[model samples]
Target: MSRPESGAPTTTPPPTPPGESPAAPLPAAGPGPGAVAVPPSPCLSKVELRVSCRALLDRDALSKSDPCVMLLMQSRGQWVEVERTEVIKRNLHPVFSKVFTIDYYFEEVQKLRFEVFDINSSSVPCGPREDDFLGAAECTLGQIVSHKKITKPLVLKHGKHAGKSTITIIAEELSGNNNYVELFFSARKLDDKDLFSKSDPFLEIHKLDDDDTFQLVHRSEVIKNNLNPVWAPFTISINSLCSCNYDRLIKDQPGVALWDRGASLGRDVPHADEDLASGPVDGCG
Candidate 1:
């Protein structure tokens, strides 16, 4: 066929056959090559990060270092600890079950730091702890969720060179299944730390918030003189517990000393100095 006097636009479809309605032009094709590839959708989401460490150097003399991992996020040019995993006693390679939930903003570069500490004595729940420092790793939350799982070598503060310590992380977006958990927690033979009477032990349940603060969700009654006590069952929202995320961890810590609140016998009463009548616990429960 002779070339048309004018070239028709190549992008336009061929004219439809007569008596046939032109098929609706194919929906606009997706961006072609060199067309600035559309960046991913703005990632405003809730994600749970699970962490683990391997090949950690033992900081203890007698046994392996009791290691726990703390996760800190960069906030206003400063890194603040958001959450930490439970201490794994005498284990060089610890797979922490603690899941750190956080809000992911793709627009901003969200920096993160994972620090490993040999928690010999101090057992603070969250960051800025006074414990033996092991090593750390730094990365952006975007890096983690992008790869889904990543492994990075551990280093000292300020990215100082360190040994074979390394950490692995896995990221997962949260689901919308909101549920509550009914848990009955108890302590068996708690340590005694009293001068005059049995230790008064109670439980303080805490929830980690988006602002990186552990807010006290509930407090159990103080059970006096009972070392192994069964606390009443409690109901906590799964969302409150861990934002309804899967595979969350439950942590336990030693309760602080609460002096025995009991009646002191008068001098006339020949009662031993240790004889402390536990005060009425009617209101305690």
Candidate 2:
């Protein structure tokens, strides 16, 4: 037997030198269960909304068959439609754009559908068909719906509304089902300084569905001061319906009636001006 010379058994090794650090254990070859790869940087999912078109360049050039874009804001469980008027100038190359204001109260809604409608100022029967006006031609318009994630903590200091933060969003087109797009956004909070106590804060949402009629999908109210809240992504499944003859829906002796009613309900179609100029022309083929 070997002689027992040591004061203590030597199985344990000596302490590591102060200058050395234990090797960082090799990263696990694969992610372990329950460890979701730190959920993809929310920024990776940002999406941007782009609205563009042909007829939008000239209001006078508008016709019943001219293509126009419609955006339906669906959020807080309500759906509101916005009609865009095309803007055109004499010298510009038919650039189109429109601005929509949100006037609903809701929370946790962040997806929308952009519907492309072919409208003929002549077809709606609200105005005289002008022979000098450009005959019905097809036009294209597009809107982008994008979002950004709060990569770093967003500190919305009580009064700071102009601070910008970057985030990522995933985007999908309302008309295209298989296409999914990603985008990044540098977003700033809306300045509510002008908002009065009675004035509701408006946030726009896009709805995706074939039905002109929309049901309340969800309902929510703003919680005054919730911190570090993470919202799970939600999607409104679209049920595509056969294109219906929407012309019959508008029945009027003069186009003014629909406009008057719309104006009363604060639901006036911004593009109603086109109807006024187009006159009461028959849309039925």
**lDDT of the candidates, in the order given:** 0.65, 0.28
- Where model 1 places Cα greater than 4 Å from the true spot, the runs are 1-43, 122-131, 157-160, 180-285
Cα-based lDDT at residue 206, candidate 2:
26
Q: Candidate 1: worst 10 consecutive residues by lDDT?
A: 264-273
lDDT of 2 by residue, 13-85 (tens): 4566889975432432566678877644332222223343332222244333343444555557665554543
Candidate 1 lDDT by residue in tens digits, 1-285: 665345332344679999998864343456666788767878588887878788898888887777788899999999998888766666787766456889999798999999898875534445335447889899999999998779999888677655888899877666676576676666655556566766556555545544554443444555666766666886765654565644443332212222222332121111111222222222121
Off by over 4 Å in 2: 1-50, 53-65, 75-78, 87-95, 103-107, 125-285
As a whole number from 0 to 100, the lDDT of residue 215 in candidate 2 is 18
